[model samples]
Target chain A: MAYLELNNVHKTYIEGEEEILSNINLSIEEGEFVAIVGFTGSGKTTLVNLINGLLEPTRGEVLFKGEPVKGTSHERGVIFQNYSLLPWLTVEQNVLMAVKEAFPKKSKKELTEMVAEYVEMVSLSHAINKRPKELSGGMRQRVAVARALAMKPEMIIMDEPLGALDALTRGNLQDEILNIWGKDKRTALLITNDVDEGIYMADRIIPLRPGPRATLGPEFKIDIERPRDKTEMNDNENYKQTRNAIIEYLMDIGNERKSEAQEELVLPDLAPKDFVNQFK
Target chain B: MKQSVSLNTAGKIARFNIFRFLFQGSIAKVKQMDPKVALKKVAISIASILLFLGLWHMGAKALYNKEADFKINKALEERGQAAADSEAACIASGNPDCQPNTLPSPAQVWASFNSLLKDHGIISADKAAFKEKTAALNAQREAENLDPIVYTGRPSFVDQIWRSLGTVFAGFLLAFFIAVPLGIFIGLSPNLKSAFNWFIQVFKPVSPVVWYLLVFMIVKTVLIGSPDDSSFTISFVSVGLCSMWATLVNTAMGVSSVDNDYINVAKVLKLGTFQKIFKVILPSSLPLIFTGLKITLSVGWMVLIAIELLAQSPGLGTFVWEEFQNGANDSNAKIIVAMFVIGIIGFLLDRIMLAIQNSVSFVKTDAI
Candidate 1:
């Protein structure tokens, strides 16, 4: 069985009347890193929300470790895009809160050691005493990463975790996250709008097409080796081909949407015979 | 001996270099120090005071001098009739041209205040006894067909201040006991928010006096059922209801305004309901809660005075009203003193709240 299975998942958010996600089927292995890439309005967040049990799917089930997902639990830790560390808590406290909640039976000394160990792993030991407001945007996100890792869940779901950082900061944190994942391989899924980020960090890149009723369009496997170097991978033949394929697929979907919109404007006033003639 | 001499020579060289550095640093630092800021501040303060005094003296001279002229003209005519009396003889013989009988200077008021303290029994008697006697006399005057007497006795300022402070604290605590938890519950649940929102909206804008009147009537008709009920019942109820509104509104706003992201985080963490409220909800809502308490306290003070005025309660407010009705020549002086006392007490109350706020408030730095 796949380590984490999402079977024919469907989500609909009727803000009056609109379907957000129609059908999404994905099977991720135990150590595979999957990235769902899509436009801003696409159902990437909704899909991740379903997997994390933050939002329930209108249809289908999410199976983890051969069991159906029920509700939000410490088993699946999430790193949100806004770096939702409590602004009132210190960096150390933020991480410690998660650790404490995840392991209520642990001794205070043990929890302190656990928090310190993970904070050190993220190279944020120096900023442990600082509050979230005292840290920069990048530092706050690093604290959030430390917090998620401290929980030591079976899986970690990231929703555009690096979307708010600068390019250099994002690249640095991307490497840091990969190094952490390498230490202990866990099933992971990332939702992002960046194609390059999807290719570099994920084992498989899944593109979600945007629409009134959207669904997963295609899946591209990133068969790159572990500890992948971006500079070296740029020269690899397979990396270029895989990246081009995903981009082309996304661009084709964009063109299809554009033409559909154009047809709406022009075809409304046309006769049925004229519309058929124009299509020919 | 030879080794010691070599060590001494090295130490001397090090000491010389340190002294040289200190001398150079002191000279540079001294040169950079500027006295201009201090000088400018002092100059501005002096100029402002001088201008104020100049304007004041001009007004006094113009208005008081004219009144002084009329008084002196009357005194000269009365001097001929009182020449036979010894007190009038002394007044007639003195330099009548120099002394102004219209407006007293700061110096004259100070002298008069001292004399009143010493001779008029204003500041020399037992304060508690004096307050009791004054109250009794006022009550008697109201009972009989007679005008009330001026309070010639002075109560201890410190004692009066403590009494007023104790009342404010008691009333505020009572208000909080009723307001905070209700506000939190109303803020958290939409059903409660909707149900009570209309009442809060209507009652929040009503004046404190209106609430005080309602409280008074309720106490009179329902609780006491006596025309001669003690003033405490009316005062306590008035202050409590009037001051409780701000805390209710503020607490509700604070709880409802908690970031939804925090709630999601709590849910994801699988925190229990108690844990969520105690750890996440309460801490996040502290700033607004403290702000509400501060505002409620100040409004309570204003309402307290208004209640005292209407209910004939024995407080600073009653003291001021009684002084105003005395119709005595020195009634203005008593009113001024009471105003000063009220202002000082209000300022100290706000400062106390501010100190409490600063101690418990969460401090967020700019780096995040």
Candidate 2:
């Protein structure tokens, strides 16, 4: 059985109203790294939020380890977009807070060492004492990455964690995350709009359609060899094919949205007065 | 220490120099200040203050008679046209009748402050002597197992200032404790927030004097059978009630507007309700809460004098009122001294709050 399963999950924010997501199904096996690629406005965040148990699916089950996911748990560490960090706390302190909460039985010295290790892993040891406001956007995101990894969760969820960084910083962080995940082989779900990021980092790529009744599209399994290098991937024929396929799929969804936009705002012909007259 | 900061504007560079000067002694601060710019700002600030004092001295000296106003009025009254008319004419001519009555000159106020210090020293010495005389009687009472009597002598100027400080702090602390938990509760639940909104709005605009009266009445009634109903209790409670709204409103606003990402992070961590609030909600909301607390403390200090006066409490307010009523030669100058003291203390109190706010806030909050 898969480690996490989404059984035909559907979510509508309002009662008896617009459905944001419908028939979203997925099966993530243990130690698998899966990335969901989609166009903008694909409700990509909402899908992972459901899987992380930050939001509940309206009509389907999000099962974690064979049980329906209820709410957020330390078992799934989430590295959110926009770097949700406590601005008052330093980078080391930010990771230490999560570490302390996750492993209450660990001594203070052990937790401190663990926090230092993760901060070092993200190459942010120089900025370990700086608060979030003092750090750059890319540096703050690195601290967020360190904070999540230090928790030692069974699964890790990344919601476009690299979305806010510059190109150079983004590439460096991608390699760092890949190296860490390669060692542990933890169950991971990454949500991104970047096709290359999905192909390089994730084992399997799933595409989601644009929302207001969005659903998952076909999955692309990357049969490329492990421990991939960014420069090396460009030379590999399989990586090229996989990246092209994902981008092609996203473009198709983008065209679908353009047509859907035209059809979206057609108000019903029946007005309130007409409905009242019919009632009378 | 050798970090370079290039600036586009001279004004911004000057401001940065000032900031660097303020933080010069801190160990890890890397700001390199231009000494010329720092000196220029300091010189300008001191020059303006000196200019203000010069203007004040000139205005008061010109407006007030150096001497002999009483003699001029008396001579006019002796002519018996009308005493009131003579008094008015004498005042217009800058006679010495208005010496003690006119707006006090800066020098006179400064002299009065010094005199008040002398008076405090004398009063303290007298009180000590009185305590010494009563020591034997008090000891006898203690030996007999009766409660020893405390010295109920008149407090001096320094004592009054000290007492006022104590009372204001007590009031601010009361407001803080009462408002913070209530604010958190209201902030967490929308229904409670709406329910509290009415009470907060209604009571917030009520005058400090009215609050003082309400507190005095309630405290008096409650402590009718006990020794706890001092005017001190009444004044502090009134001050607390008057200033508590700022904290309550700010705390609720802070809690409700906590960032969405932090809330999501808390949920993803599977934090329990208590942990979520303390870990995510409180730290995120601290900036606003501290903003509220600073305002509340200042407001409490502002209203404390009025409360003390109305309650007839022994603080700076009472001292000012007593000196005003004394109608002595230096009474007006003494009142002016008290005014400056109050203003200086209020500024210091605000600076203290600003320091605390900066430390607690995630960002280095500018002293607004």
Candidate 3:
């Protein structure tokens, strides 16, 4: 059975209103690295939230380990784009808090060591005592990544975690996260607007169309070999086809949305006399 | 043999650094440190205070007129007596209390402060004597299985300060207990937020005096059969109710406005409801809630004086009111001293709250 599955999932915040997501069906196998690419408001967050059990689906089910996903669990760790580190806690304390909660049975010394280890992994040991306000934007996101990885959850979710970082930092953390994931082979789901990032990081890529009724688009498989080099990928044949195809597909959706908006103008109902008077 | 530096030397080094930062390094640091701005800030503040005092001296000297002699001479002239009779004659004849009411000069206020301290010392001595006398009687009463005699001595100036502080604290603590939990509950539930919002708006604007009277009526009725006069309870309860509105509003706002991202993080962590509150909800919203609490504490302090005056409680408010009614030669100056003391104490109270607020928040509390 797939490690995670979303079966015909539908969600609308308001009852009987337009749906944010409709008929989303996905199955991610164990240890699979999957990335969902979409526009900014394409219900990607809603989808991730549903899978994390932060929000309930309006219809259908999100299954985890072949069981229906209930409420939130420690098994699914989330790294947010905005670096949602608690503004009041030092970087070390922020990671320590999550570790403490996730593994309450660990001794204090063990917990401290684990926290230090993960923080060191993210190369934030120098800033272990600094609060969120004191850290640079890149450092804050790194701390968040450290916080999630430290939990050692069954699955890791990244909601455009590097979306806010500068190009250099984003490239660096992306590699760092990829390195960490490679070591553990943990099931991972990455949500990003960056198509190249998805193709580079994931074994499979799925596109989510823009909403008021967003649905999953056709999947693209990256049969590229493991340990792929980003710089070398530019000259690679498969990379060119996949990147061009995804961009072409997204552009088509954008145009589709635009024309659909143009076609959706409603004509007001009027009596014959009122309709004739409109000309005058 | 060469030895590595020990923890003790490390500790000393740290302490020396802080000391340097304050003394010599501070000036150098001011040339280089933040809070480095500290020395210049303090210097300017002291200068401003001196300037203020100088202005006050000038204003007071100009405002106070020697009207007593003029009034007395006019009265004498009306009665066809020698209006040239020296005003000094009245004083030389043992009438020393001849000063007219005016805003006291800073020097006069300083003199009154010293005199009030002396009076407080005398009152303290009296209280000690009373306690000693009652101690023996109290021991005898305990031997006889009777209640001990209570000391009913009047509260001194210092005692009034302590009383006011105690009353304000009691009110603030009570308000915290009532408002914060209610606020969290209301914050978490939209239905409750809407339900209780109207009540909060209405009661928040009600004056402390009205609250005091309302509490007095209720407490008075309850204590009719009971011998313990409940002025303490009345004053505190009124102060709490009067000040609670700010805390409640602030707490609810803080709680409700917590980042949706953090809330989602809490859920993803699989935290229980209790864990969600203590870990995620309380900590995240603490800054705003503290902003509310600071307002609550200050409001409570501001209202306690009026509440004390109305309730006949022994506090600084009553002290000021009593001095106003005394109509003595130095009463105005004494009142001025009380005014300065109240202002200083209010400032201290706010600093105490700020210290606490800073300790809890990850964000360093910045000054206004």
- For lDDT, the strongest prediction is 3
Question: What value does the lDDT take at residue B282 in candidate 1?
Answer: 84
State the lDDT of candidate 2 residue by residue for B24-140, as single tens digits: 333122234566866786799899999989998887775565434554556566865476476667567656445436678888899899988998999999888988998999999
- Per-model TM-score of chain B: 0.64, 0.84, 0.86
Candidate 3 ranges with C-alpha deviation above 4 Å: A104-117, A125-129, A258-280, B1-47, B66-77, B80-95, B129-142, B146-153
Real contacts recovered, all predictions: 0.75, 0.81, 0.84
Please count the clashing residue pairs in each candidate, in the order shown: 4, 4, 4
Which candidate, 1 or 3, would have the higher TM-score against the true structure? 3
Q: Which wins on DockQ, candidate 1 or candidate 3?
A: 1
- Candidate 2 on A69-188: residue-level lDDT in tens? 988888989999889998767888789888988999999999999999999998988988988888898888888888888888899999999988888988888988889998889989
Query: What's the best-to-worst order under lDDT?
Result: 3, 2, 1
Candidate 3 similarity to native, TM-score: 0.85
Off by over 4 Å in 1: A263-280, B1-154, B220-229, B363-368
Q: Put down candidate 1 lDDT per residue, A21-98, tens digits, no spaces.
A: 877788999988999999888877788788888888788888888899888889898998898888778888888888
Interface RMSD of each: 1.1, 1.3, 1.4
- Tell me, by DockQ, which candidate is best: 1
Question: Residue B218: error of model 2 in Å?
Answer: 0.7
Per-model TM values vs. the true structure? 0.77, 0.86, 0.85
